[model samples]
Target: MSKQAVALTLTDLNADTPCCPPIAQRRIPAESAAVLAPAFKALGDPVRLQLMSMIASAPDGEICVCDLTPAFELSGPTISHHLKTLRDAGLVDSDRRGTWVYYRARPTIMRQLAALLTVEAT
Candidate 1:
């Protein structure tokens, strides 16, 4: 029997093109929902949510894992797992420099999420 290799690719959250119209404006298509649901699920965890805020608000547009670990009581590995979840969700990107790994928010995805949630005053 031959085994088939499945390749998985993440949606480019940083693309210039918008993923879809705002959720308030129209119903989201299944493909867009499939791509975005994981990102929302990743943020459903409080720790991951805070981590996302920190990475997004970092002055230099990125922050180191070493710096992020000290802010939480969780162990380094636990924090890393959460970061990995964010990475897989296409909400953030990471770079390793020596012993430290830095994370940067993908602003395009953030903007898309914000737009979807925005409710104009009637």
Candidate 2:
């Protein structure tokens, strides 16, 4: 990863290129790696990754906790813990409505994560 690899731009994700020149092309910057590592960490778990995908791909842009809990075989508290992990990572947002809690995806961070992982034409 070189300095250039660390300096991500919107066009990197938009144009005909991968995100960066590739870790092989240069050295990865500590700052860029630090900012992106958490996102990868958050997704390292199968449960959390599934939860993130579920929330991100939700039909109405959000899903209820009740809905999420029943979809998994894990206990309620365990699911809650995973959801909390995502929330703390700035990946999801939750809110209560009546008796149910609903969660929505945070697209900004998702986009940022996608951009950081991109490779370039070079």
Candidate 3:
């Protein structure tokens, strides 16, 4: 048996770009799935999922690492690791300000993920 390797290219998950009509509306392409699976995988963890919600729901559209760290019992490094996972998955972005780092949700990817899971009532 021969195995064929698929070349993976980064797919822009920008909010302005329409990723797909809808998961229910049409079939998702394999390439698109390859690009998007990582995001879902990143959120598979309970800690990461809660972190995403916090960042997304932050009043100022961003939250400081200090604010985020205290919310969980985990240590600073554990929280930072989760934040890094989110950043790597393109679900969030962080900026360093003074002595603190702030994280903000990427609306484009959030919208895309929401749309993918949206199911119209029949």
Which pairs clash (backbone N, Cα, C closer than 3 Å) in model 3?
none
Name model 1 segments beyond 4 Å from true: 1-12
Q: Tell me the TM-score of model 2.
A: 0.75
lDDT ranking, high to low: 3, 1, 2
Residue 104 of model 3, lDDT score: 97
Which tens-of-lDDT digit does each residue in 24-73 have in candidate 3?
Answer: 88898776787778889999999999999999999999999999999999
CA lDDT, candidate 1, residue 101: 86
Candidate 2 lDDT, 33-116, residue by residue in tens: 665566678899999999998999999999999889988899999999999988866678899999999999977667766755
Q: Give all TM-scores, in the order shown.
A: 0.86, 0.75, 0.86
| Candidate 3: residue 57 lDDT (0-100) | 96
Please give the CA lDDT of all the candidate structures: 0.82, 0.76, 0.85
RMSD of every candidate to native, in Å, equals: 5.1, 5.7, 4.2
lDDT of candidate 3? 0.85
